[model samples]
Target: MRQNAERCTAALSAAVSNYVDIFEHVEGQIIHAHQKDQERKRNCVMMPSKKLQTFLSLPKKQMKKSLSETSELEKELGNYTCALHARLSPNEHTAIKNSDYVKLSESIGTSVKQAKKIATTVKLIRNVQKQVKKPEINPSKEFTMAALF
Candidate 1:
């Protein structure tokens, strides 16, 4: 049983390494496709291509919301680090602030950095709104009539 456990661990390690390699290759392909789409005058919306679609379909699991939910369309692009490492105990929700957190520009490009910032800003705004309460006013006589003069 111990031998089998060791073998399973080794296999899992190899599998994870292989997956990282595949993800790296996919990232490169996504970058290339993005550049190509930029160069082309034609929009993907009019005629969707497989490369474009696959690149867009890549799971952005780290985001609190999807690209469509955010105000800025480009904010979805970023380096998607696995949440498995970042996630802590059940009580801990926010990721620990550390240099270990991979920046998108290091793996991807500058575009991703800007996008991530926008996404973060949007999230902050939403959080602030949630915490704040608006003052209620009576519609019948909230404003003074003397102010009109």
Candidate 2:
């Protein structure tokens, strides 16, 4: 049995010298993978700067676009509110104008105080719109969306 073990050891040593190194092959594969990983990291790192430049530039253009959209929305809201106010029957308008909070609240499906407050606010906004519409106004005098809120 000892002789057979010695022969096997000798065959293993011979095979090691005769064949490609298993450890070296594995190490090469590991190194190749590491290099691929580094290259991928490098490629990924380069992309963000170009994307950042575009991303940064977009806000300026988008700000202008968003501002215009906001203005359009404000205009539409004003027109819609004016239409709503106009559509109110004389009886409903009289109830709000008379400060009859209970009747207004019941009619509008809101709390007494809340209904009165909302009606007054809408009335004031409609008045502002009326004044603004008649004139080719100064920019400073222009009614902005901020005042509505």
How good is model 1 by TM-score?
0.26
- Writing each residue's lDDT as its tens digit, candidate 2 over 1-149 gives 99999989988998886565877888899999778655543431111234223322444445334435567544554555655555454556788678777887786566987777757655654554454345445665556644666
Model 2 ranges with Cα > 4 A deviation:
1-74, 136-149
Worst 10 residues of 2 by lDDT: 44-53
The CA lDDT at 39 in model 2 is 54
Each candidate's clash count: 0, 0
Measured by TM-score, the strongest candidate is 2
Our model 1 lands, by Cα RMSD against the true structure, at 18.0
TM-score of each: 0.26, 0.36
Show model 1 residue runs off by greater than 4 Å. 42-149
Worst 10 residues of 1 by lDDT: 79-88
Q: Write the per-residue lDDT of candidate 1 for residues 1-149, one digit (tens) a residue.
A: 99999889988999999999999999999999777645442321121234323434444432323444553432322212112222222211122122222343232233555535533433443343333224345565556544565
lDDT of each: 0.41, 0.57
For model 2, state the Cα shift of residue 90 in Å: 2.5
